[model samples]
Target: MVSRIDYDRDMVQLHEDIQKSKETPIIRKDRIRKSNNNNTNSVHKETLEENIKNANTLHLDNDIYSVYWTDTIPDHIQESHPYIAIMTSNKPDHLDRLILNLLKNALVDPDRILVFNDGVDPVLPILEKYEMTANQLVQNSQTHTKVKGDQNQKDFYINQHYRFMFSFIFDRLHLENIIVLEDDLVLSSDSMGYFTLLSRLMKYDPSIFCVSAWNDNAYLWNSIPDEPLDHLRFSFKRQNHFGGLGFLINNRTYFNRIEPAWREEGANYKPWDTVVQNSMLPEDSCIYPSVPRSQHSPILSRNYKAITSKENEVDEWSFMQFYNPADFFVDGKYMKVYRMTMAPMLQPEYDFNLDRSIRASVEIDSLYAIGFLTTSPHSSFVFYHRVYSDKDKDWELVTKILSLVGIGNGGVVRTVYEGVIETSVLGKRLYIVGFYSKFVFEKHRATKAKMKLNDLIKLVDYGNAHFNEALTKSYLFMLENDHSLHVKVAEQSESCSTHCKTHNFSCKEPYQILLLNSGFVEYSFTSQKYCKTIKIAENSESELGNLPSLYSATQTCVLPNNPSKISCSYTPAKNENVTRKLCICNK
Candidate 1:
């Protein structure tokens, strides 16, 4: 419904473009919803109402834009579980605006806010004016650091500020989690509470390394359905971008793992955000909401002041929906993927023997067990390669099934010989599983001969084989007998088919009637970095039906290397009625 610029621009500019230089909307007492549903303590209702009434009477020009307020401290807040707001800034106005925003909208204790001042501008006056005199504000006016007098120096200063903030939070305060922000950002009404919930989730799951409040895909805000906003938060292995604007960090990971790793590398040449982003554990991800909780207020950031001119851009979506802890789910799909090592590992038989005579018959051999292992319930497929020297002096490689383990603790194995063992207890079956590996080398002929005469060489040979162990042995025991393997296999096959059908459409390639964000169906692709947004007319079902049949079309988008052409025809999804026809084509 809203028109956006073709080029990527700041939110302020978008606001200005829409409003045409109108005065900024002032916060009014009536605009404040008289409810504590916004994660506010009910006791704050009276105090907030009085404050709003007083502000309205004063007719303040730059009133704090808040839709809700509360004075009743939450349990986490009352227990001194204050979230330290670490802000890096040289601009006094920026710092003042950010602190003002926090005071009005954030749910964190104001006393715990920390400011790392990079400029000589006295921020304490600003703090004192905003009733933040007790705030822990520190300054790092380091001018002696050898600067090449370039952008690199500016980048270095940014990292230095962050280093100082992290060190203070890690060693001095010894806090576990912290909310960090750039000075030129404003907090949404629900930001502090949102971060609190995310921090709690981080404590519960160690795999979540960071929690971001800024969404890079905010441009697609219109395409998202607002109804599901309260229920979903995307868990991504890769972030949309470096979230230096607003993010939560686990100080344990920062101090124990990331800081040590950065120092070990001499902390040279890389951006601070990049250092932190790359320092996450191999299997961890940063979780963020589809809708962002913070708005980037600075169009011309201090570091980028050289590139962008000072322009007042209007921001329409500065305020967003309030979210609560009880309505959010953290686990979701990854937009881009990283290494997934959780897949099963398969090893069918032993190797490194000179003789192939020990190989089992086809019926008993584990190689034939691939089918049973892969199709087993709650399992992931793994590929393994094995090499062996045959009696004829030829080397051969074999691919075989190593093991089948269930998701979590459902599948079990008792012995390597019996892949997934199932035992019936009365009428129920139980499963228990374990995976183990050992190295064993082929016996030397001379040692074998000497062992026949003396047992001393046999012990030495055993020691050598034990040291060179080359095979893995797995065992699993059935813990429950209620599940039938045959039924599971059938269900898994059907599930896999459905999953494949649902996710088969490639986002990069031309998709046949692919659903985009929310209910928008992508009927075409114009070989561009971003897709153009269009709206469908309010046509009746009868008018829309056969509309696609009446028209066939092709579109092209210009690329640097070549032009991309997309063809389309009216098509509906499987089992869909005639009114649902849309432009769809596939390569």
Candidate 2:
């Protein structure tokens, strides 16, 4: 367990350290100067000092500790290495795990690692053992009390932690670049080497603001398995949004652009990451790997928490298989050079109109089909006419389509491999290509009409034959069944609300009890016809007064059809000579 320290004493020590560092002035090599021009370097140095002074004056929820170093780092090390900044809170166990994983990197330098603690708990001993720098920001008691109840104030404090950390790294330490990591994440063996190679890309490309080690759509259900030869290739794609898990940011970008507009005080608190993302120019973008080099643990924190009362259990076993270092594929040591192509407009080689015969031709690789999308102004759902092509690869065509529909180009486009575009249109999750693709009447054209769901499913089925079998099956199942009626088996002891919540659904009280006949047992819930009548209150025992006995029957919880509801079904054992009672509850 992480032990707590005296907050008052820590604050006093923090104040003394800050004052001492200010009082003692020592001559040091100028590290922040990026340009060779003497006049420009002098002006940049003055601006940096002014920014540091302004940052020190900002209201502090926590005290900032100076970076500790025994000697000046050699010029070669300074030029090639970025200070590794680890942001941590009270989670010592997570911090320990992160440090251990980080140390496993062959290219990692202990002297370059810096821990920025939130000051609730200090792991000074861990830092000492690794010979790493510790910058603990002890919380201010008065500020904490003032921000206790107000959510905006809490967000401000959280945002301020980032401000303080970034300002110290850029303005005070004078580092050119820093790789930021949260304590909850574990780095892959290639993480350091990956960043090292990407750092060159950052220096080479002026338009690229950040390089991230995370693939936003790299979840097991979304990603494709790589072959042995695929491991040798290090592929990266451009994204407008900053993927923040494990990212590298330069001092020039921070001090000049980001720091100036940093939110100091506001009634509505925007997250620091969001502010950074919003501040980027239209030309600026971030580059991230096709496969992630860091894996995030699902431990709850201020930034991440359970959406509902019941904790949703993620399939970590499947997720870990994607992040296994042995399967990382890219040899980071050998992969040093990266050739990044700027925004290249790719015109479709061939475009065909939506039709019934197009499904067979879609199975051919490198085929691009123009699919018509229509949205009912009254509803949140989007309807598609045919198989959707890869949004990112065919962005030029996508832009033209969006222009025709009068929708602007500012919306983020989320891409999943194998010609899939997962997006939320009007608050509803719309899988444009995969299993959820729907047909719509093209009213604007006389020749276009709606296609059957079965036809669309067959297209996806044929197209995804070489893909993961489990994913393909799930996609087919989703397309065949009513999306509103989601059913899953639950423990006999689990409550209706909890069961619904665990499955990412809300629970409505007074669920229905479904009674299934013995002969209909072979059919699934979607196909079987059952007598459902008994209404039971959530979390209460059913009073089967005058009803058939359910002794020796097995119960299964069925999720509601409409957004958040719970329905249950019960089936009797074959050996037990009793009629089976199944209960289903709907909102």
Candidate 3:
């Protein structure tokens, strides 16, 4: 627990620092000064030769940055515990909060916690106050200048920071394992313990590259607070992407594989994390918690808010709504140890049959299913339609479903694990299998079969009254509020499917095509329930022409949930002047 006085003082100092930073120009002189003998409690003075012997030097851009340590590095560093490396960029307030949180919750020696400051001096005071050790790498003032307005330059500098940090940790510090964190994050009480336990798994399994403490889709809406302890907090899954926040990485692989292939310059340069993800071997995968132990605290820094706002063109902050600090949890240190010991034997076997798997999931109280695209040409469509309706390709609908059932969006691809896409719907786990898990499902290829949409709905709808109502209400709400619903004049040569996809949506099959004359009156309804259902027809312009003249003469408005209300007749309307509009109902 951070005391109010400490927090307040830190905030005040942070404000003053920010003001000073804006007013002061970048000083070209070296910022790394020799420690004064006056502050013995917070600083340790050492000769340059001693620094090299202790591996307390960071070489960056042809400059040697001396690492300041509050206490001497132990001669025998424990292999069981990892060095916690925190990266910060002038965010003193965030650094303060993070350090306080770590002190209060993390079961690690303060000497093992290392801070990497990216050419920022304001963080020094906070570090000194806590007597925490850090390495301050100062690039030329020009590098800092380039970062002010150019995103690419900023990315380059950030990549450089990681390069320097990694080199210092693995090459200089001679440490085997490290837990990486950023300043704009707060840890759960069990964060350090979570990583400590999982590090053993990484040691046992060479295929596992990293163990992450973040779940990309662990939003408040997607989390179930009252879920069983094991399924809720202790669950783990293989992740496709490298989740950066609070992740543990070892030095052996870094030196052997990642270091040589690391991107430092050229047109190929990208974000450090992106480069890491791309460089991962096909067999490589990250192990991540089902629920997050570390969360992004964007509100902690004004700079973070400013950067995110400028980059909001991509809707980066849209997922912020799903983040609730209270959702982060870890069962306990004892349980973590037990789970770690049992992890090797707890790996699940793949279920190839969708129907059988779903049935089994229904019987189990808690489950996760990962769906994969089959070799069949229609596999993507079939899986899409069955899990979610074929009406639209909106990923948000899939997200909402997962949220309602209490699940995280495993990573960026949402509900994806070890390349396999995962979600729970109607009390059953569904997976759209990815390439990496082919070994598990490919052998059982002959057993794989698709479940029809109607059959799936029926299976879940049969005695599960609560799930039925919840699913219906949620589905209906999405349909009613869906903005993709639109009217388009029927094209002579184009189909509804092509048209809908043109607008980046999936067509609601059996499109409602309405024919009305100039004098036709449009029907109006206050509620979706009052909206009339129309006859379901094939994807043809002539299907709706069979409707009665009276119905065809008047303009019709149809809601997505209601069935087609247009009464069909064998006779085609003789009226040639009537305008035809195709209603594309997409969710």
Best by TM-score: 3
Give the per-residue lDDT of model 1 (tens digit) for 1-587: 00122111323343354366443322223223332123333333343334433443212221111112221223343223346565655567777777766665454577778777776666788878867764477776663233457787767777777777788787788888888888887665556755664465443334456777865333221122223322133222223123545888887568656687578564645667766755644334455554566667664232112112211122322212222333333375222211111000001001111012111101112222222231234222211113221111111112112111111110111111111111111111111111111121123222321102122122222232322222210000010111221100001112212322344421111221122111112112212212233233332322211222111122211111100111121122333221222222111
TM-scores for all candidates: the values are 0.40, 0.48, 0.51
Kindly give the stretch of ten consecutive residues in candidate 1 with the minimal lDDT sum. 341-350
Deviation in Å, model 3, residue 516 alpha carbon: 32
How much is the lDDT of residue 218 in candidate 1? 36
- For every candidate structure, what is the RMSD over all alpha carbons to the true structure, in angstroms? 24.9, 19.0, 21.3
Give the per-residue lDDT digits (tens) of candidate 3, residues 1-587: 12235434643454365456542111111222222223222211123223323431122101211112111112332344677888877677888878876765443567777887775446667877777644432233323332575788788888777777788889888888889999888666566656776675444345567888877654322333244544454556675467677888998568755686684445135677766665565445677776677767666542323322321211222222211223334553233222112222112211122222332221111111111111112212212211221112343445443442123222144334433455433222344433333322333443555443333233332243433443342333222334544444333233444555666665442223112211011221212222232432334433332321222244333221112222111122234534332434343
List the global CA lDDT of all models.
0.37, 0.42, 0.44
Model 2's TM-score against the true structure: 0.48
What would the C-alpha RMSD of candidate 3 be, to one decimal place? 21.3
Ranking of all candidate structures by their lDDT, best first: 3, 2, 1
| TM-score-based ranking | 3, 2, 1
Off by over 4 Å in 2: 1-81, 105-107, 133-148, 225-233, 263-268, 298-322, 328-587
